[model samples]
Structure formats: C-alpha cells, structure tokens
Target chain A: MEGSQYRGYGMILLGAVVSITIIRLAYVLYWIGRPLRPMPKHLSTLIVLGSGGHTAEMLRLVNVLQKDRFVPRFYIAAGTDNMSLQKARVLEDSLLENKGIGNKDIEKLAYFEQIYRSREVGQSYITSIYTTILAIVHALWLMLKFRPEVIICNGPGTCIPICLVAFILKVIGVRWSSIFYIESIARVRRLSLSGLLLYKLHLADQFYVQWPQLQRKYPRAHYVGCVM
Target chain B: MEMSGRHQSPKTENQMVFVTVGSTFFDALVKSVDSQQVKDELRKRGYTNLLIQMGRGFSIPSKSSGEDGSLAVDYFTFSPSIADYMRSASLIISHAGSGSIFETLRLGKPLIVVANEDLMDNHQIELAEVLADKKHLFCATPQTLHQTIRTMDLGSLLPYPPGEALPIAKLMNRSQNRARSSRSLLSPPRHFCSNNSPFFFVDVGFTVQQGRTGDSFLGISFSGCVLLLHTARPRLWILLLHLFQYISS
Candidate 1:
C-alpha cells in the first residue's frame, strides 16, 4: 500500500510535467507560422525611453516612423531621467512643426501624449527588487490606461518591467499590443540583458538586430541594418 | 574665473577636445589625461580646450601654470546634455560605454575609445575591439591614448551613416502581415476574464497545459513565472526557496 502511494505521487508529478511541456510546444508551433499584419493605420505607441544612449537610439528610430500614423506617442523613462523627457519634448515640437501642425493645431496631430517615469535600476540586489516591484505597478497602470496598440523600445534596464507588463497583458488576454524591440546598434555581437530576456521569453513580436552577424547568431532576430 | 578665460578669448578658434568618462569614474583615464605629457601633446595638436566630465569620486586634474595657458582645461562633475558639448567639439575621447561611443558616432565626430580594463567583465574591451576593427572608432589604452589621439586623422575615420529606416521598416512590414493572419485564425476571446472569472484561471491553466510538450516546458514555465513574478514579490519567494533548500539540505 505504501509503495503504491509513492508510485501514485510520482505518476501525478510526471503527468503535470508532461502536460506543461505539451502546452508550451503547442504554443511555440502555433506562433511559428503566424502570418504578418500590415502596419495599422493608426497606432497608439508606447516608446520606452532609456537613459542616455538608449533614449537617443529610440528617438532616432522614432524619427523615421511615420509620425502621423503612430499617434499620441507615450514615452516611459526612468524616474531620475530628466534628459530623455527634455529631448522627447524637443523632438515633439520639431516633429509637430515638420508635419505642418502648428502650435494651436498640435492638439489634433501626433503629439507627445504623456511621459511616465518608472523606477531606475538600483545598485543593490535588494533595492533593485523593491524598485522593480514599484516599476511593474507603474507599468501595469500605464499599460492599462494607455491601452497602446503597439509598443516599441530599444534595450534598456527600465524597458524590462514595461515589456514584462506587456507580456502579462498579452498572456492574460487584456490587450493584444504588438511589441517591437530594436536592439541597440552597439550590441553588434550579442543582445543586451533586456534584449536577451525579451527574445528568450518570446515577448517581442518583432525583434530586430542592427548587425547581420547577430541575426545569424539568433536566427529569430531580423537583421535590420543600422537603426542607430 | 574659467568663464572669463573662455569668453575673453574670441579670437582663437579653440579646437575643443571633449574627454568624458560617462557616469562612472575612471581614475585611470582621468589621470592619464591629467598628466603633463598629455597636456603638452594636446597643446602641440592645437587643441585649445579640454573639457573633462569627471563623473563621481575622481581627483580633479591639477591646474598647470605654464607659459602658454591656451589649453583651457575645464572640469564638470556631470552634464545633462553631454551631447551638446560632444557636437561642438572637434574630437571626442570617451570611455567604452555604449552610450558615449554611439552618441559620438551618431554626431559624426571622430572618437577615441578607452576601455576600462578594471571592469568586472571584459565586455567593454570586447566592444571597443569590435568597434575599432570596424573602423567606426579608434580604441586605445592609457599608455597608447596620447599616441592614438596624435595619429588620429579625422578625415580618414569612417562615417557612421545616420540611421536608415528601410531595413527595419521592411522587417516590420513582413512581421505585421504575419501577425494579422495569425490573429484571424487564433483570436482569443475579447473578454476572457470579464465573462468567466473562475474559468479564466482554469483557462489559463489549460492554456499552459496545451502549450507544454516536454520536460523543458515545466522547467521553463517554473523559471519564467518566477521571473515574471520577480517584478512583484521576488524576495518572498526567494526567501521561501532559501528556507526550503536549507531544510532539505
């Protein structure tokens, strides 16, 4: 009787393991041949801005995006980052002027909607844990409120929480926002920590690398030539 | 006092050399530049201004009392817009931080990258070597910095093409088309949680079961969920895991 009880426990555990494996495999296979969709006519975009270089690279990419199409651009940056906010404001004004949308009409055009500040990566593991939780709460609230159709970011520590929030939203069927991750140009050989996470988790619907070699290294990642 | 020195001299077109150590203090890089030897070298090269952004916990370069004080060396703890200084400068000398390197490259400025070998990982060294190999930027050590800067021909440095949209746009277009068709076939119910509260949990569980196929899936989901929950209450689970491991041990 004792031996049979042990065996029963083992079988249940085995069954649980097997079931989970099958489910994951099915999901992967289903996504493997998924068809592409055309760029939506109007997209509420959430651009996760990193401090310094990440912000600069994302801004450069944002410059090329059809401004009129990606309306009501929302920016997320680390709480401490004033530079990115300043830069985004400057970019917004210039973008508006370039689109021939005057100061008065800026309310109607593709304007910088709002800037949300998430927790920056902390130095210590314990502090980082606390900050990360705060960041996620902030991110979840933003994701729900913004209800963005598309999300775009270059790899930054702060992007992780926001991306994870998006992933959860997708998983829970809250929203079907497409995540587009553009790996930083500097990451010629390998993906940054955030990039690696998004790639591994299948969080990014579209993952792009700046270098051809990186594309070869990670077959899933598309080699998009020099998006700065 | 230094403000007066800079403004007073409008006649001389001071070839500015911006030496930035980024947010981290690199005493080695700072000390190398602060040396009398480097000072003389810059003077010889006709670089009149040396703006050093010494970030955190580094000794300031001692002011030199030389015959020709034309090399107006200025120090700042930090700047919100280092790019402004970078753009105006003739040449940029920076630590091998990706931020500094790319910003310089983006601005189309000739850059000399000094890798901090003392970093825990040699990733910066690797990055510097790769970038140097591509001729996108010049790499140098403290020993070789003076020589690298002296020999650097700005004209010969490879121009970093401003970011192009075609490659990314094409991939995005392809991915979008694929996503659209996939959505049509396998669209999740619009309100899975709203209509069925208790069933939503069961459905999520079922979704996990359906997706899993091998032993790896269990491991992956276990770790992945922990990672996902890491943003929520990582410390609690971590402590519990530690206790479990301790008791088992």
Candidate 2:
C-alpha cells in the first residue's frame, strides 16, 4: 500500500511538469510564428539610446525615420548617462523645428525614460549579478508602463534588460513589441556581448549587421551594408 | 584664458589640421601628433595651423609655433563646438570612434583614422581598415601615423556613401503589423489602445473603428465588421461587445 501511494504521487508530479512545458512551448510558438501584415498609419515606438557612440549612431538612424508615422516616441537610456538623454532632446528639438512646431510641445510627441544600468564598464562579475537584478526590475516596470508597439536599439548593455522584459511581456500576452537590434558599426568582425545574447536567445525580431563578414559568421543576422 | 592666449589670428587662406581623440584619453596619438616629425610632414603638406583636442591625455604639448612661425600649434582638452573646428579643417586625424569618423567623413574632410592599440577590444581597427580599403579614409596606428601623413594622398580618398534609414523604417513597419498567430483563421488584428485604457486592445476586426471608451480609438464607422475583441480586462470586453451589438441593431 505504501509503495502504491508513492508511485501515484510521482506520476502526478510528472504529469504536472509535462503539461506546463507543453503550454510554455505553445506560447513560444504562437508568438514566434506570427506572420507579416500591413502596418497601421501610426505606431508607438521605443528607441533605446546609449552613451557616446551608440547614441550618435542611433540618432543618425532616427534622423532618417519617417516622423509622422512613428509618433509618441519613447527614448530609453541608462540612468547614469546624462549625455545620451541630452543629445536625444537636442535631436527632438531639431525635429520639432523641422516640423514647424514649437519646443513646448516636445513632451507630447516624445517621451524619455531612464533605466538602471545592469553593469558598468570594468565592473566585477560577482557584484554585477546583484545590479543586474535591479536593472531588470526597473526595466519590467517601464515595459509595463509604456508597452510600446515597436522597439529599436543598437548595441548597448542597457538595452539587454529592456529587450528581455519585452520578450517576457510577449510570452504573457501583455504586449507584443517588435524588437529591432542593429549591431554597432564598430563591431565589424564579431557581434558585441549584447548583440550575441539577443541573437543567441532569439530575443530580437530582426538582427542587422553593418559588416558582411559578420553576417556570414552569424547567418541569421541581416547584412544592411554599414548603417551608420 | 590660456586657450585664447595660445591662439594666433587666423588667415582666411590658412589650411588647418584638426587632431581629436574624442572624450577619451589617448596619450599615444596626442604625443605622436605633437612630435617634430609629424609637424614637419604637415608643413610639407601645406597645412599652416594645427589644432589638437587632447581630451584627458597626460602629454600636453607646449604651445609653440614652428621655426618659421608658419605652423601654429594650439591644444585644448575639450570643446563643445568641435564640429565648427572640424568644418574649418583641411585635414582631420581622428581616433577610431564611429562618432568621430562618420562626423569627419560626412563633412567631406580628408581624414586619417588612428586606432588605439592599447584598448582591449581591437575591433575598431576593422572599421578603419574597411573604410581605408574603400579609399574613404586613411587608416594608421599611432606608430605609423607619421608615415601615413607623409604618404597619404588626400585626393585619392572617395566620399563615404550617405547613410539611409528607410530600409530599417520599412522593416519596422512591416514587423509592427505581423499577425497574432499562425492559424489562418486567426488573421491579423488591428490594435487599439489609448492613454485612458489600462490594457491594450487587440480587436479582430476586418475594419476597426474606435468605440466610446477612448478618444484615441477608432470611431465606429461600421458596427458589424468586428468579428472578435480581445482585451486584458474581461469587463471591458463585455462592455465593448454590448456596445457593438447595440450599434448593429
């Protein structure tokens, strides 16, 4: 009688694990299998900016975007980085001027948010584990708050947590954000750490490489011919 | 200020060579450019003025004119309007940061990008080499910079192709409209949400118009076209269903 009871308990536990795995797999397939369709007139976009070079490259990309279509833009940067946010504002002000609009109305069409940095340059790996959690929590809060329809980012360590949160939201059916990751032009022969993770984990919807050799190494990434 | 004291009055026809290491300290590049050999090469190339943005480097060269006072030497740690300096330059020798490289290239200035070898990641060298191979800019290391300056033909470098973002924008738009699922029966739905709604609306409508809930939502043009309405809240779904039925009847 004791043996029979133990077997029954084990079977129930096994069954529970199997069913949960199947459901999770279904959700993954459901989201990943989505087909392309016609875009709407306007989309809420999230642009993740980083310090120095990353911000410069991203702004160059933003400069060429269709202004009217990608409205209500949100620019996310690391909390420690003031320069990127300042640069973004300058770009926004210039964009407003081009549209013949006043600077006072800049907040209505564009929003800026700062997320905690997961790890600082040259930070020890052990301590970074703790900071990484903090960054993820902050990212989750921002993701839930905005739930943007489109997300575009270049190679930035700060972008990793936000993109991860976006993927989690998709899994839970909270929001389906299309993630676009453009490898930094500085990364000619190999992808950066952030780019490698997103590519390996399939977090980015579309991965673009500026160099053709990098595309050959990572077949999944699209070679867009030096998007600088 | 010393910055103003070191400067001499500029001649309209004077050609200036701008050396920048951006926001980082690159003592090697600064020292190389400050060396006598490099100064003589610039003079040979007909450059009359040398302006160096040294960043945080330790090797600050003393401000002194050349033997003939034909070549003026000036150095500053940082500048807010570096682009103005770049614009007036006849030649630019910049560090291999994409920001500095592209900025100089777009200005159509003759550039020689020097890669910092001390940095752990040497990937920046690849960018410099590729651009050099295309004849867009000359590439050199700190040790070889003088050689590059002496031998590089500014006229041989071609203009970098202007960057285009339209392809990425088109890709983003196409990705935004992707269908919700693989099932043919479950076709793509038009998303409807506004600041007022706590949750986004993924309504399966052949033609979707907003209801009374949010001003940003589509106004009701045809009531019967919405086949399904999916929302994060069940209460909102029932309310929307009732409103749709009320409009149709």
Candidate 3:
C-alpha cells in the first residue's frame, strides 16, 4: 500500500511538471504567432535616433508622422551625439513653426533621452561586446520608464538592445508595446546586421524593406518603397 | 564677365580636398593621403588646400605648408561641423564610413572611399564595393589610392538621387487599417504593465572619454514602490498570485 501511494505521488508530480512545461511553451507560441491588432490612436511613441544617416533618416520619417496622433513623443539618441540631439530639436522647432505652434509648446510635446553609444559598425569585437551590454541595460530602463506603446526604428546597431528588451517584455506576459523595424534604403542588396537580428529572432512586429528585391528575397518583410 | 573669369582662374583659386577619417583612428588613410606621390599629384592638379579632419590618428602631413606654393595642408584632431568644410571642398577623400559617404553624396561632391581593412568584419570593404558598383563613388586601398585619385573620371560618375521624405502619418493610417483587416497572426503585444499606479522607475548615466582607447562607462539603477508593496500588505500577496495566474493563462 505504501509503495502504491509513493508511485501515485510521483505520477502526480510528473504530471504537474509536464503541464507547466506545455503551458510555458504555449504562452511563447501565442506571443510569437498572435494576430496583430490595429495600433490604437493617440499612441505614446518612442523613436530611436542613431547618429548621422540614421538620425537623418529617422528625422525624415518623423517629419511625416501625424504629430497629434503620436502624443508626448520620446526620442532616444547616443549620449555623446550632441549633433543628433540638436538636429532633433531643430526639426521639432521647424515642425512646430510649420504647424503655427509656438516655441513655448515645444517643451510640452517632446522629450529627448540619451543612452550610451553602442559599438560602431567597424569597431573591435571585445569593445563592442562591452558597449552592447551597456546599451541593453540602459535600453531596459528606458522601456520601463517611458512605457511606450509603439517603438519604431531604422537599421542601426543602437536599435538592437531596445528591440531585445521589447521582446523580453512580451515573453514575460507584459504585452502592450510593439516594435517596428525599417531597413535603411542603403541596404538594397542585403539586410543590415540589426535588421537580420530582428528578423531571425522574430523581435519586430512589422519588418519593412525599402527595396522590392529585398521583399522578394525575404517574403515576410513588407516593401514600403524607400521611406528615407 | 571679366571679373568672374579672373576669380575662377586655377592659379588664384584654392581647390579644397577634404580628407575625413570619421570618429575612429584610421592611420592607414592618413598615411596614404600624406604620401609624397599623392602630394605631388595634388599639386599637379592645381589643388592648393588639403583640409583633413583626422580623428584619433596621429599622423600629420610632413610638409604642412606648401613649399614654393605647392599645396597647403591644414589638419585638426576633430570638428563638430565638418559640413562647413565639406561645403567648401572641391573633392573629398574619406574612410569608408556611411555617414561620410552620405554627407558627401548630399553635397554632390566627387568622393573616393578608402577601406580600412583592419576594422572588424571587413564592413568598410563591403560598403565601398557597393558604392563603387553604383558608380556613386570610387573605392581605393592605401596602395592604390594615388592611382585611383589620378585616374578617377569625375564627369562619368552618376549623381545619387536624394530620397524623398516619407509622409509617415498617411502611411501609419494605411498600415493600421491593413493590420486590422488582415488575418495574419504575428502582431506584437500592446501593453506590458497591468497596474495603472507607477511602481517602478529606472535611472541611467553614461560617460564617454575620448582617447586612443576610447573608454566608455554606463550605469543603471532601478528603484520604486514594487519592493515596498511586497511587504506593506498581506492582501498584496493574493493580488500578486492572481496576477501571475492571469499572465500564465
């Protein structure tokens, strides 16, 4: 009788473990394969602005966004890149002026956040590893505070960490934020390093390529036709 | 017309050649540009001024001031507004960085991109190859830089068409509508935090020190009422249990 009771207990424990494992797997699959809902109107959006070309491309995209729909917009750039910050501010001022909005309202509309510079495209491996780790930690903090509903980025090394954080938040059942990855127009023949990562990991909700050839190569990627 | 013609004279005009190595130290690029052969070639072409924005690279042109009015080379460690220099430049030679390439293209200036082979992953070579294939710019190595510069057909190169700025608002609306109607099941989650009350916050600090080593440090801190909530009330435990159940389900 005692042996039978022990076996029964073992079976119960085994069943519990199996069920838990299945549940976790199912949760992951649901997140990975769920239907995309329409982006809610009046989104608190976060835009990651990389240095130089990345910044210019992002600014061009931002200039066309319905500013009223993306209320309280937040911009993230490298801490060392004063030029990018200045450019963002200048763009904002010009945008406001075009809308007939005064300078006094600028403070109320947008906020610029700075994170540590990630490894540049041609930087050494060891140094890049260290900087990438730092960027991930900083990106996590930004995500937690900003609580952005929609995050958009073009192909830049800096976007990788932030996208990873968004992916993590989704896995842990904190749903609400979506990442949109747009490959740069310069990437005509192949996807950039960051673009490849987001694609392989299934981190981005919607992935776009500027060229039609790329879209044909990666059937999953949408061809948005050069949004530089 | 006479005044304009005099102003445009090759001897009186200073044709600026801007050499930029971007933020990283590219000693090879600096060395190639400062070579005796390249200098002689520049003088032959009537290029009077060479303005170099040498980043962390230590090499300075040996003949800084042109002897017998050959070529006057001026270099600075770095510049905040290299655009000003680019605007005045008749030709640009730079390390194969995307930023430098894009900026030069935007200004419709003739350019030669020198690949830094020592860089990790051979990215510069790849970019240079693409740009060269497009006929947007010339690609050169340190050994071939002089020859490439001498033989480059600037008139035959294609002008890069500037991309039109996208109208994001209209695109966003169209995308949203498409997403809503589509049966595709791969959308990102919409919310992460369930509680309306602010329970967590994060602080970040970063510093970048400029030098050959280029040391950078990042600090992050997480603080808020979440920890206090765990201890403050017995009812919180039940709520937490329910929340976990909700998430798992």
lDDT digits (tens) for residues A1-228 of candidate 1: 999999999999999778766664455434532433345677778888877767877888877776767787887777777778678878888987776766986555433433334333337776767767887888888887777767888857778878888766655445557788998776878788889998987878788888788899999888878765
**Alpha-carbon runs more than 4 Å astray in model 1:** A1-29, A32-40, A102-122, B1-13, B69-72, B79-84, B106-108, B125-127, B150-156, B182-249
True contacts kept of 3: 0.30
Chain A TM-score of prediction number 2:
0.88
Report, to 2 decimal places, the DockQ of model 1.
Answer: 0.24
Better of 2 and 3 by TM-score: 2
Q: How many residue pairs of model 3 clash at the backbone?
A: 6
Better of 2 and 3 by lDDT: 2
Best by TM-score: 2
Against the true structure, what is each candidate's TM-score?
A: 0.72, 0.80, 0.74
lDDT of 3 at A83: 80
DockQ of 2: 0.35
Index of the highest-DockQ prediction: 2
lDDT of 1 at A104: 83
Model 1 scores a TM of 0.72
Clashing residue pairs in candidate 2 (N, C-alpha, C atoms within 3 angstroms): B209-B218, B210-B218, B210-B219
